[model samples]
Target: MVTVTAAVTEASSELIARARAGDDEAFQALTEPYRRELHVYCYRMLGSVQDAEDALQETMLAAWQGLAAFEQRASLRTWLYRIATNRCLNTRRTAARRPATQWSVPGVEPPEPTRLGEVAWLEPYPDSLLDEAADAPPGPEARYEQSESVSLAFVTALQLLPPRQVAVLVLRDVLGFPAREVAAMLDATVESVNSALKRARAALRRRPPRAQHEPAPPAGSAAEDAIVAKFVNAYESADLDALVALLTDDVFISMPPMPFEYEGLSAARDFCALFLGTGREYVLVPTRANGQPAFGLYLRADGVCRATSLLAITLAGNRVCALSRFDGSVLPRFGLPQSLPDGP
Candidate 1:
């Protein structure tokens, strides 16, 4: 194992040397391995897929330009993360993020919302991309599981945090980077990093706790399938009672890019009734987002089903704990079509 490891390291070093010498292919080879994970990190930081993509491109460009200065004191992965994190911080600070969209469905008046959500620019991360970065393991200091860290609820909570606290928390708790390494990455002292982490943790804890609910069923397990199947059936049939029965007592609902949010079972029920009570028929194309069950929602009218939105749910045991509705504009990111032919 030692010999194999040394040989792999030697090859990586050679790739780095070639990349530094301006070999574009070598540079691509060196950075490609970290690209998906870096993108995920950026998504966690920025909350928008488009913004994450932009940050990722900028990070790669900066890395390539600064390759000569990479002294290899840290693993290349950590170095990439440092670049990605800083790039995301810059974006969070300067970018004009997407604005909140209004409730504009034709002939449908949504019930009064429970409250306006703060994270209006949030977008779902496609699970397909996550498969490519599956092997990333958090360090010993990590406080969240990999799947939990990527959930819609967790990511939404992250967006509410200040950018520096988000960075510190993600590096120290989510990705499990050591305090010294995180401080080095952020060009700060370890003491400051620790302080930021403490504040971030406290802020996160102050947010509503999902820990009180039972754990979600394992991905793709029978338990999960049963819940998803019931959701599809209830939603398609417009059976409000059946759908409501599948929700936890405190089930939360929010539509991003649109500020509407509904919390608790009653509010969720009202929102669902308003949405489903419309005379139009519907269909759901299954997909996964942010490590949770998601579907491309389509409105069937005049024998054609047109995409309307994407819905991702957070399950606590057999019942859903939260539902996130994203704009239909994100369907392409998950390889879902904009429209589908009406089913028999």
Candidate 2:
């Protein structure tokens, strides 16, 4: 084991040397392995997938340009995370985020929302990309499971935190980086990092707890399939009663970029009723987002079917606890077609 470790270290040294010597291929080779995880890290810091991608690109560029400054005091993975985190912080500070969109569904009047959501720019992360990024287990100090850390609820809560607090919380609790390392990454003292983390944790605790619901079924398991199948049947058939039956008592609904939020079974049912009463036929295409079940909704009208919205649901055992809707602009991100052939 010692001999193998030494050989691996030597090879990594050679790669780093070549990378610093301006060999683009060597840089790519050295950085490619960290790409997916770094992207996930950036996504956690910045809710929008587009923003995460931009931050990731900037991180790579900066890392490559500053390769000579890498003193190797920390592991490559840690250094990459530091760069990604800083890039995300810069984005959070300077980027013009998407504003809240008005409710504009034709022929359907939306009920009074329980409250407007604060994170209007929130976007779903496709599960297809999560497999490899989440495969590696988090470090020993990680307080959140890899799956929980990526959920919509978690990501939304993170967005509500101050950018530095978010960084401190994620680095210390989610990724399990030591406080000293996080302090170094953020250019702050360890005492400040701990203080920020404490405040972040208290704020999160004040939010509604997801633990109240029963645990969701495993992905792709028969239990999950049954719940998804029922949802599709009820939703596509426009059976409001059946759909309501599948929701938890505290079911929550939010439409991002629109700021509308509905909580409780009654409010959720009312919202669903409004959409179903639109006198339009609908179709659902299965997809996954944030490690949960999602569908691309298509509206059939005038003998033509066009994509309408993307819906992602959070399940608690057999019932759905939350529903998040995003505008049709995100369909392409899931490889969903803009339109489908008109048929039964």
Candidate 3:
């Protein structure tokens, strides 16, 4: 086993060397590891999956053409990030951003939920991908830096930041790049990076405090699983009483890009009861969001799939403390298919 592990490590090292030497296949192997994360970074920066993918391809092309100029100054990972971040910012400058939609897809009809609150721009991410473990190690700062950046709220909030501030904060805070390195990436001084980070932190603090959920479910305890099961049943059933029973009295729920947010269980319950399960029946296709159990909710309208929403419930201990409903158009970012299996 030890010998086999060493061989794999040596092979990966060889691939990196060859890639650095301008071998396409070797470079492909070397770059593959960073693709998903880089794409994710672009998505956060641009707030569009299509744009992020385009930027990812552009970053690779640039990296390949400039491989000869690659000095061993920074790790290959950081170099790629520098390239990807620049691409995203450039795209942001030129790209035409479509207004966000809260419903599932372009063609799908939507059910009447209370007055829509400018949530059309908010989108859903697949729960499956959010459940996947991140490749990067937990950075030096143990808190506020985790895979949760993949969450819709975190990403949406990031989009609200200035483009440069977005890159600086993400590189320094999310990806754990040092201040000096971030400065180099942005072609700015360390002091500038510090200033940007300060403003970014201040802006973020003003937003609703999001719960930092655990990445992986607790092992074999059944605590989180039980909670998730109860949530699924309560939500799909539209049983407001059962749902409120599982929540704390002071539980809060908010959807970003929309001004409407609810505080307290009664208000939340009333909102859900009135808005959800009113005219259409809902089928929750289970997925993960915000590093917690989430559902890809499909609302049937006229016996056809109409609307989809991504729901991530934040639990405090075993009680649901917050529930965030995001629009479904962004599910592709999470690799969730547009159509779910029928009646599963």
RMSD of each candidate relative to the true structure: 1.3, 1.4, 5.1
- Candidate 3, residue 156: the lDDT equals 69
- Overlapping backbone residue pairs in candidate 3 total 7
Q: Taking the tens digit of each residue's C-alpha lDDT, what string does model 2 give over 1-344?
A: 99999998889899999999889999998888888888888889999899899999999999999999999999888898899999999988888878888997777788999999999888999987887663346678889987799999999999999899999988889889999999989999999999999999999999866548899999999999999999999998999999999999989999998999999999998899998867767899999999899999999888778999999999999999999999889999899999998885
**Model 1 per-residue lDDT at 198:** 92
Candidate 1 residue-wise lDDT, 42-135, digit = tens: 9999988898899999999999999999999999998998999899999888888778989967778889998988887899999999998744
Badly placed stretches (over 4 Å) of model 3 are 1-23, 100-120, 127-134, 138-143, 208-221, 250-263, 275-280, 300-307, 327-344
Error of 1 at 305 (Å): 0.5
* Greater-TM-score candidate between 2 and 3: 2
Q: Taking the tens digit of each residue's C-alpha lDDT, what string does model 3 give over 10-49?
A: 8867876787776899988878878877877787787656
Worst 10 residues of 1 by lDDT: 204-213
User: What TM-score fits each model?
Assistant: 0.97, 0.97, 0.76
TM-score of 3: 0.76
**Stretches of model 2 off by over 4 angstroms after superposition:** 208-211
lDDT of 3 at 95: 66
